[model samples]
Target: MDDGKLARMRQWMLTEIAVETACVREQIGKAQLDPQVMDVMGEVPRHVFVPAAFQAEAYLNQPVPIGCGKTISQPFIVALMTDLLDIHSTDSVLEIGTGLGYQTAVLSRLARQVYSVERLAGLAREARQRLDSLGYANIQTRVGDGYLGWPEHAPFDRIMVTAAPPQLPPALLDQLRNGGRMVLPVGPHDHQALMLVRKDAQGQSSTRVVLPVRFSALEEGEAADLF
Candidate 1:
């Protein structure tokens, strides 16, 4: 599709996201998402992040499959999660699941640097290439177990996990800097809730459920092949 058409579709998607946000305002505690998050959501070309066969569904306010049984998160969830993080221009963010780098792309526009970890080497490689081609120079990606939380770059100002874990991963909590925030889906594959976790200056953490959601399970242990 042409850029004009894609832009129009993206506008529709944004409208849908706004409407969805309003529908769940009570749970999320806000009627609208952060304007900055919406702006970055609008700027990122989601079509470029999905498989060629699914690009036409890129701006539908839904998740598009990116192979390996993983689906890029729904646009509303992406915006909500990113908004929950309250990312700052000077902050360093760590993303746990880099499926095609859609969320990473969004985070990259808001944070100074993004450290992303993907469990599948193939997906990590493709995501890295796509981000590079799009001129997102501040992102560094590595294929590793997302549960490990990139220890080399621990103590991140913010963290976002795309996949759902049965519970909060301990390493992720340790990596979050004091006063940092994290958003992710927590629960079994069939039943999950989008959760926002906040760590205070004293490193005590509190969590709240933002809304209901379903995401692929966060794989554990060694990296694997996407195919």
Candidate 2:
């Protein structure tokens, strides 16, 4: 696709996201979304992350299936999660469930580096290639059980999990640097809440439910390991 078409799509996408942000504020009774978060939502080309057939609906305020029964999250959720992290350009982020790497791409702009883990080989490969082609060199992807996180790169400054786990993974919490923040959905498959976990500089952790959310279960077991 030409740059012109993509630019137009982005403009249309920004308009829709702005509306969604307002509705989100009204629902939660907040004033407005963080400006930086909204800027990233507008800039990332969501159209490049999903299957070509779904590209036309990429910017809509809903998750789009990205094959393997996984999804690229809705813009509002993405913006909310990113905003919660309060990332700085010097921060290193650990991202679980890479999905199609849309979140990874967004993080690339706000963080120094992003370490992403995905169990599906095809999805991991595709996300890596897409990010590379798009000139995002700050993201590194690995195929593994995201439940374990990337321990070798422990002590991340921020952690973002893209799938819902039955509970918070201990390894992820342990890997978070003191004073780091983690955002993830946790609960039963059908019901969940976006929980923000914060580890203070003193190493004490606390959690708060930010919003109700529904997401696919984070994959595991033999089938998840196969690819």
Candidate 3:
């Protein structure tokens, strides 16, 4: 799309999907988010991450399926998690699932580096290509099981898991840097909560439940011995 076309589409997205109501605005303000986060949330083209058939509903403030039985998270949820991370420009982020790369694209604008993992090879390839085409050089995607977390690039400043795990995986905690924060959906597939785990400077971790949510379950490995 040309610059003018893209600009017009973005405006439509902001008007139709960006949460501009007084109540949501108040909630965002109360969340203590950086002003830039709101700006970026409004600007990113969410429709592009959805399938072409669902483009019209891309900015509807609800989750939309993006193939592979996975859905892109609601915009508010994305904003909430991003705000909670308190990311700085130099922060290195680890994203557990890349779904359609919409959230990854959003994080690419906010963080210095993003390493995302997707279980489905097709989804991973598509996300990588889409991000690259959009000039998002900060995001690196790999096809793998997110349950193990990415170990080679341990000690991430922030880690966001897109799927809900039955329980918090120890590997994820181990990969977090001291003082880092991880935002993930925890619980059963039918019922879950968005939980934020923060590791203090002394390596002690604390968890706080942020909101009720539901997502696909984190996949387990084929090897019986692997946890």
Q: After the best TM-score superposition of candidate 3, give how far the Cα of residue 104 lies from its true spot, in angstroms.
A: 0.4
Q: Which candidate leads the pack in TM-score?
A: 1
Report the lDDT tens digits of candidate 2 across residue range 1-227. 67787788777766776676677675445656678877887787888888899988787778898987788888878888898899999999999988888999999889999999988888988898889889998888998888889999888999999989899999999999999999999999778999999999899999988878999988664325324
User: Which candidate order results from sorting by lDDT in descending order?
Assistant: 1, 2, 3
Q: How many steric overlaps does candidate 1 have? A: 0
Candidate 1 vs. truth: CA RMSD? 0.8
lDDT of 3 by residue, 1-227 (tens): 46676677666654543443334554334624567877887777777788889887776677998877789987767877887788889999999989889999989899999999888877787787778778888888887889888899888999999889989999999999999999999999778988989999999999988777888888877312111
Ranking by TM-score: 1, 2, 3
TM-scores of the candidates in the order shown: 0.98, 0.92, 0.87
User: CA lDDT, every prediction?
Assistant: 0.93, 0.86, 0.81
Q: Look at candidate 3 and tell me the lDDT of residue 41.
A: 77
Comparison by lDDT, 2 against 3, better one: 2
> Where is model 1 more than 4 Å wrong at Cα?
none
Q: What is the lDDT of candidate 3?
A: 0.81
Best by lDDT: 1
